[model samples]
Target: MRYALYFSPAETNPLTKAATQWLGRDAFTGETFPTPEADGLARDTIHELTADPRRYGFHATLKAPFELHPDQTEAQLVAAVERFAADTPAFDIPNVIVGQLGRFFALVPDTVYPDLQHFAARVVEEFESFRAPLSDADIARRKPETMSATHRANLDRWGYPYVMDEFRFHMTLTGQVPSEYAPAMREELDRRFSEFANAPLTIDGLALFIETERGAPFTVHRWLPLAPVSENRKIAS
Candidate 1:
């Protein structure tokens, strides 16, 4: 089975709920939102511009989508993920606020924390062997023109472009907005998130989402809290 590790905003967070409604269709259910008519309209507008139905919805990818090695057992993968979480202590995410990443909107950190950056980097580096190499066709579809030299190199090497320095954690709210609609989208997102923006959000938990194939929305399989590692425990690969 293929899996992607992502950082998702807590469902209980009001801002997240608001944004979730605005997205209209839950990528998870593929069902359209019934209430909040304005939210549906905004979502439709954003989705039209993006024109990529498959990329919609929320969640921030820490490790890009990858298929696990067929030979590896699920038990082995779960054990590895648990080991990584245990060794890494949970750290606070400071200044989490809604912001635009190009045309799409997301909740991003105010400043890059060394611990989080290092942790993400380690995930990319250590679990890389589990990933199938990106095919030339997939690379071509990525379009080098849309990315920087560094990002292109990352894609070629890591099978994902947004890792290491290019990484910015974001829970995607929309696909991409047209220039004409950018102002309106930004306004709506800011207004929707304003209530929660005043305070800090702590990220103390790690979750595992399992998916079987392409075009599937992963369900949360495990939510593990990051705890202090014992000095005597040696982490095995």
Candidate 2:
């Protein structure tokens, strides 16, 4: 199995519920939800648009998926994740918007937040020891030749092309939409996610997701909250 560190809101969070419904699958429950009707789009069209994101579920990736290092045990990795979550304090993104990334659509921050970047980078760096180096097959799958020199270098060193400076936090909502379908998809997304637009999104926790096989749907193994260490100290005192 391959493991990924992802930022997932609490299961009860409205955004989480809406996203899962939009994609027609719940990562937490491993259950399929019916796709909500969109006025201008056919149900099949919406399903096709969301096919990719549905497989991965609703979350922003922090540390891209990897097999654990030979020296590391899954138990150790889980403990490390729990420890990291307990020590880290939560923060919020001032605003989020439904935006298109190339042909795909996602929820993206309206502006770059330094704290968000720092947090993502920290996740990548702190977990490097637990990541097994990417296999040659994995490297080829990324199509490094099409990537820029810097991205190729990042893949070599970080095992994923987008990390550190290259990372742009996005919670993907759909796969590539044809140009003709893009406008309708955007409108539907805006209507469905309107409450979240310009709203503060709390970065409260991280989740561990596992894919049992190469093409299997990823499921949440655990969700850990980011409780401030100072809060624990205060309670103890």
In model 2, the runs with Cα more than 4 Å from the true position are 229-237
- The prediction achieving the highest TM-score against the true structure is 2
Off by over 4 Å in 1: 10-19, 24-32, 39-43, 46-57, 145-147, 228-237
Residue-wise lDDT of candidate 1 within 1-237, one digit each (tens)? 567666554455565466556655444444566434344345445546433323434566778777777677667777877887777765566677877778776677877877678878887887777777777787898997798899989999998888999888776665677677777767776777787564576555555666666666565555556774455542530
TM-score of 1: 0.79
Of candidate 1, the 10-residue stretch with the lowest lDDT total is: 49-58
Model 2, 34-100: lDDT tens digits are 8678877899888888889999989999999999999999999999999999988888888899998
Overall lDDT per candidate, in order of appearance: 0.67, 0.92
- Model 1: colliding residue pairs: none
lDDT of 2 at 223: 97
Q: RMSD of candidate 2 to the true fold? A: 2.9
